[model samples]
Target: MQLKIVLAVLGIVGGSAIALAQTMQSNHGDGMDHVTHGQDKPADAFGLTEPGQGAFAALSEVVRFLEADPETAWSRVDLTGLRAHLVDMDRLITDTVVSETELPDGISALATGDIETRATLRRMVPAHAAQLMRDGRWAVEVSVLENGMELRVTSDDPAVVARIKGLGFFGLMASQDHHRKHHLMMARGNDVHAH
Candidate 1:
């Protein structure tokens, strides 16, 4: 039973790696179809397999998906919009200075940066707070200040409160699996932020 569970978990995790590898292979047309040919190729032969940095890897994945789809509307594809969103993410991660305060229920985080970063914070924090609220776990609130953005997260359960404090701002932002689907939609010219 344990082995079966482990295999099931691995299958779920490995599915993405397999899809990525196939996408990379198809994009490159390297004449080596490992899935079909059963070639015992060295893993290193597939380049770094790191797929570059975070934003680049994400854009690459989106592009690969676009390329793989036969019905993809190239005319409707909006990579520029996707790139802008990725830039906002980069600013959020690299530019912001975050100070976290412990709260009885969870934590309060004030994230500050330059003009661009502050704008990013104002735009993203509340959106993420809304996303967190949907899980029915944590109560997240956001305030946009002149120089910074403030996020307050709390929970009813003591353990969840502890988890909220541990996660702080960034981990909370990274919590959901909706990001991948959101990116895909954005790349396909859909306004994911539209209410």
Candidate 2:
């Protein structure tokens, strides 16, 4: 059982790494030169957009830095460094003008999942997890409950959940609705027994 959990955690980490790699590769050639969108355009498309661009630029800089020399880059990145990166990225996104362009349903779903996963892991894991946001990419500590495995997600956005689920451990962290329903059912069962 333990070995299975370990394998599952490895699978998730490996899958997320691959996804991040693919995303990075796909976005590599563009590098903030242009913005590509599908059929729908965001409502606030032209409102105020410099910050997002700047944030992406900053992210690009970090990616380059890491690519140039990972060993040195990693050493320079401490907890504070990670937090600073996140702040910078958050500032870039929040300050920028957002549009009604539906913001991509997948992006929102992934963000929601990311937030939930972070919260769940934080609550369940004893070790501290670090987060870094740079060059439009983010590195967040993701924990697998099966074997207490720790992995870092490197991505431009919060769309790392798909990769997380691919690892197979995501199902272990029950969704909020699932937990609530289970609790409700248990409570009902207890009520019947008490009567």
Candidate 3:
């Protein structure tokens, strides 16, 4: 028992030391000396806080929120669904190709990818288009194509049109501030895309 306890303590201390070293190295590049910036406490007290990787960080945040809330329904939670959605996001970002064209009112884009990527685009693009249309900012339409998907966005205002063209396909897909809330809702077993 004593040997196990000693090993556990050493493991934690070693992990903390690694985190502190990584934090100091990262902050060094930004011209911030983490060591001298503190007068009251040692720099080792501050360490890397992020849980690493974009998707993992997002899921960590959701789990933290759920743990803090008393009303979280543990039985209804669907973290697997959220993980699948994050995988889809990754595929969308890395595997797709987009071709854009200037339109009189806005812009048109054709997005194509391999077999798996095309399936991801088909699932995500129309759902995102629905979310964008709810704001009434632009007329968004998504058409399923054999090769991939087609997205056309239009607005009567020239400024909004220019903004649409500037944003192109990826920007428009990522435009909404709704993703975090959607993730939380989906984790709680709510059908976020149903509406």
Top of the candidates by lDDT? 3
Better of 1 and 3 by lDDT: 3
For 1-195, candidate 1 gives per-residue lDDT tens digits of 999999999998899888888787575455554465436656346465457888898999899889989989898899888888889888898899999999898999999999888888887888878888897778888888879999999988999998998787899988876888988998998878842
Candidate 2: tens digits of C-alpha lDDT, residues 128-189: 22212222343344445342234343444446545433332222222223332322322223
Rank by TM-score, highest first. Answer: 3, 1, 2
Cα-based RMSD of the predictions, in order? 15.1, 27.0, 13.6
Which model scores highest in TM-score?
Answer: 3
**Model 3 Cα displacement at 146 (Å)?**
0.5
lDDT of 2 at 14: 100
Q: How many clashes in candidate 2?
A: 9
lDDT of 2 at 132: 22
- Output the better candidate (1/2) by TM-score: 1
Candidate 2: where is the Cα deviation over 4 Å?
Answer: 1-52, 70-195
Q: What's the lDDT for residue 183 in model 3?
A: 95
True-structure lDDT of candidate 3: 0.89
Q: How far is candidate 3 from the true structure (C-alpha RMSD, Å)?
A: 13.6
